[model samples]
Target: MKRIFVLLAGLCCISCLYPQAPATEAILEAFENRSRQHLLHENEAYALTSFSPAYLFDTLLPAAEARYKKHPDTWLQVHLLRLRANAASNHRNLNNNIGIRPESVTLTEEAIRLCHLEGNDLLLAETYFDMAELFNLYARHEEYITMLTKAFEIADREGHDYFPGILLYHKLAGMCKAAFHINSYRESIHYGNRALAMLGALKRPPDLHTEIFVYDLVGFSYKMLHQADSSIFYYRRINELLKGRDTSTVFYKLWSAIANGNIGENLSAQGNAIAADPLLEQWERAGIGFGDSANISLARKAQAANYFRKGEYDKALQCWLFVFEWSKKEKHFTNAAAAAEGIASVYRRKGHVDDAFFYFRQSQVYNDSLTAFNNRSGLQAVQAKVKLENLQQSLANSKALLKVEKRSKQFLLAGIVLLAVIATLLYNRQRLKAQNRLQRLAQQKREAELDARKTKEEIENFVRHIKEKNDLIDSLRDKLSSDTALKARQDILEGLSEYTLITDHEWEQFKTGFAKTYPSFFPAMAARLNQVTPAEERLATLIFLGFNNLQIANTLGIGRESVTRARYRLKQRLSLSKTEELEELIAKW
Candidate 1:
């Protein structure tokens, strides 16, 4: 009898471990049924990407809620709430709502509370991540960061293989990429690398979609940092990974075209415009084939930049004009502003000062419009108040006129004169306000132009000084080589070589000046700084300053072969491909 009791107790314990298995299975079955009834590609793994809110609200959420009500289980409740929150959030996003829905936040918070109450770390971490996603959708970045940090801490402590580890890192990478701040790109690359490492470490065949997205994010961050070789390397990796996949599918074609365009852009930036042409053309063709207007616009902009860099001013102007018109028509102020700026630059290069100034002002107008739109709430409130005051004043004027009319003719005439005076005063006030606003804008534009010219002059002066120093060193080396007693004066030669080499103090001054012009340069190089030797760092800096191999060798007091070897070693340390030019990479920096 005791043996039977022990066996029963063991069975009960085992059952307790999988208490919600049936409930989970039921929920999944309902989900599958609903997806089959509504989704066109129900059996596909990515069917949810095309999910409609109606399906979520009318079918999936309803079914999940019913199951939760029937089962009265905390796990089921949490699952249902998560689905509900996702549905609400998706609905808001699809409708292009200004902010996240309160219901979505509430549902996610309740799910989190339930998870905490149940002591389920995994569930709590997932819910926190869900909350983070909701915050991200609304661009509440601080809250998003907080939620993600909490989720990561919990997931790290729990040691979950995939739930929070891979997913959280991927989301963190994406978040950092979209942050649009200095150091954000490096942070993005850092997280993206981590995510990629985690994906590779997985025992199972990793999700290709997640892996590709992380690669794309990292590649884009590199591109923004002007690490062209690194950018192209990762983009090419995407293309390689997509091999043998269905070429006709939107997913395959979209990513493939994006990769091609990005690689071409990087190549063009590296001054390989001829090599980039075919790739850019392929990307543009794909955009046209897919009828994607945004992609077409982006491709045109990239082509314009390439042409502009290659001194094809006419071609650049044509492309910029097209983008400008299209963007204006679409009311995309940001693109319109960019196109206008490009147009102005092209005109300036062509020596069309008036046209350049006109376009510059046009760009400014578009920028101002964007600024106003971003602050539309306050502007709207101010406008509303002005309208209300005008209405109230008009009402008062009407009452006064009525009272004057009831009095004698003299009073009526006086009232009419007083009203005319008031009207004149108001007209003068509005005209003065308009003039003042225009004057302020004009002054701001002039100041901006002056500041830009000053910065350009300063950078030119700095570069010229470095070139002059290098020229002097080169001259000294030429004289030394021709010296008859050069072998006997070995100490003098060494001193000259030491003078040519940049000392620590000189390097500090160079960096300070460079940082003034390109503030993000060092920050972008921060990740690789620790790994590179001091000589390699100097080589990179010289390369970035537009120094050639001969000039770099002379500057460092080394032979050309030594410089080449150092460059090759640096390239390897940086993990660049053989075909990727180290010069192109460092010069971009």
Candidate 2:
């Protein structure tokens, strides 16, 4: 409630301080032309590339601000506010720009409120989504969630608006990916699956490559969780999707490769080095030297295993040596230790007893370190559980105490009220008794004094009512809703109907508006991002943002089998190929 008050107070201040400028019909018409074109095609792949759209949207920032000053009118202010907020929303994707400050959170929130005030539901959803992203970047998960929920509410209210639904679904899936990395895999799938389902229901060639992203994340999470069959399923789905698409996308190709690499790893782990190479080779070829430190290590390990299986001690040792040196440089302790153990094994095979012992001891050291890390994590988990239990008990006790206090206050108030009534009756009784001994004037005087006392008591009772309300809020750690007319507003739905969510036609217009504005730009942007990251990039992005492989896969509308393979690839591109982690690689990327 306090949070609500603060949010409301801030909004109230903004509304009061920033008066809307009176805009002219001419300027209003001009803006409508520009906005209609921009919003209509905003999601098109080439919208940003087209000069007219770009000029009207991105490059026209200065023009909008200039127009605001030039006209200082109602239509212009509305246009400026909407465009400015939207421009910030758009600029969020360009953090690669290094020095640009995206629109402030306060500005975004205010703009969203303004849109609501103006009944621009689509605009409100769009602005809120941006705010959610801002919260995510700042590591404020709860805030991100609140904003996301609000965005969904507005978008859903828009009804059948493709853009709002799609964008909201996209963000939810992305949030799921982030959740997976944080070890909140279930939630990851929850969001991912919803997003995938939404995508599956849409037309092909895609409105946005969101389905691909969710699938990649799902697949990667599955791989990390070691669900080999499920991982393969998602990877295979990706493969099918990539038949006509460029297999050269750093991310997409990497997953196909990782699918192969992991299959090889699984084989090699079971002592079938000969069978693993073909898969590993495919992964390597797909790599294209894209700064994949982890893949290089994994490839080397696989090669070492193959040589070891073939009884080529020297070759096996060489591969292991490379893995050892590189894993150490990359700080991949587990892989480094594995390489050390393999090196030691190779030395033993070569009859180098002392050298074998040295590598064996090194392996032991890493093993001990890993044991310690696991122990520490386990200890923390146990402590956290205990602390949570204790907190829950404490909260229960606090609630009990609050109830007792409330009852005590009620008793005291009841006693005081009874005394006031009794005293009034006694005083009136005394006045009647005096009627036989006093004049009419004196009785009238007593009546006047009694009326004054009654008025004072009423004023005191009102003050007490206010105080009690304040106390109740204080006890709840919330705001005192102290509105005397609150009895008339007992239903929350009565006032904030705008916050209610319902899916329908307005949502379709939103999608159409953005698509018309961008014109294939969604796919184009996907293509551009893919050039560096690929379709498989979603795995890393999803995981980095958080999501478990299963959830990720579900969101992508594929089996977890495919997600596993994608993770293998994501690990390589993100330079975490050798790690069993679902998080570090994402952070590195």
User: Residues 230-319, candidate 1, lDDT per residue (tens digit)?
Assistant: 999999999999999998898899889889999999999999999888888888888899898877887888899999988999988998
Q: Model 1 off-target regions past 4 Å?
A: 1-99, 113-120, 136-146, 162-188, 203-210, 245-254, 329-335, 365-589
After TM-score superposition, the amount by which residue 79's alpha carbon in candidate 1 deviates from its true location, in angstroms, is: 4.3
lDDT, residue 43, candidate 1: 18
Which one is best on TM-score?
A: 1
Query: Which parts of model 2 have CA positions greater than 4 angstroms off?
Result: 1-58, 66-103, 115-122, 133-150, 153-192, 207-214, 244-256, 266-275, 288-294, 298-589
**RMSD to native for every prediction?**
44.6, 39.3
lDDT of 2 by residue, 1-589 (tens): 0111111101111112211222222323444343423222334322222223233244455656766676675434544655454445344343433422346544654565455444566555555665555545444444555566666676567663435234445577756665554444556667676677776554433432445667766765665566756665765666666567676677666766765676666566567778877887776565537667677677778778777887888888988998899877876667778889999998898899999999999898877876775566456545644643553366456657777998999999999999999988799778876776677778888986786666556544533553454344334322224442465544432332222121235334333443443345345435434455434544444454355665455334444677888776655654443645747533443
Best candidate per lDDT, number? 1
Assess candidate 1 and give its lDDT: 0.68
- For model 1 the TM-score comes to 0.48
- Locate the minimum summed-lDDT window of 10 residues in model 2: 1-10
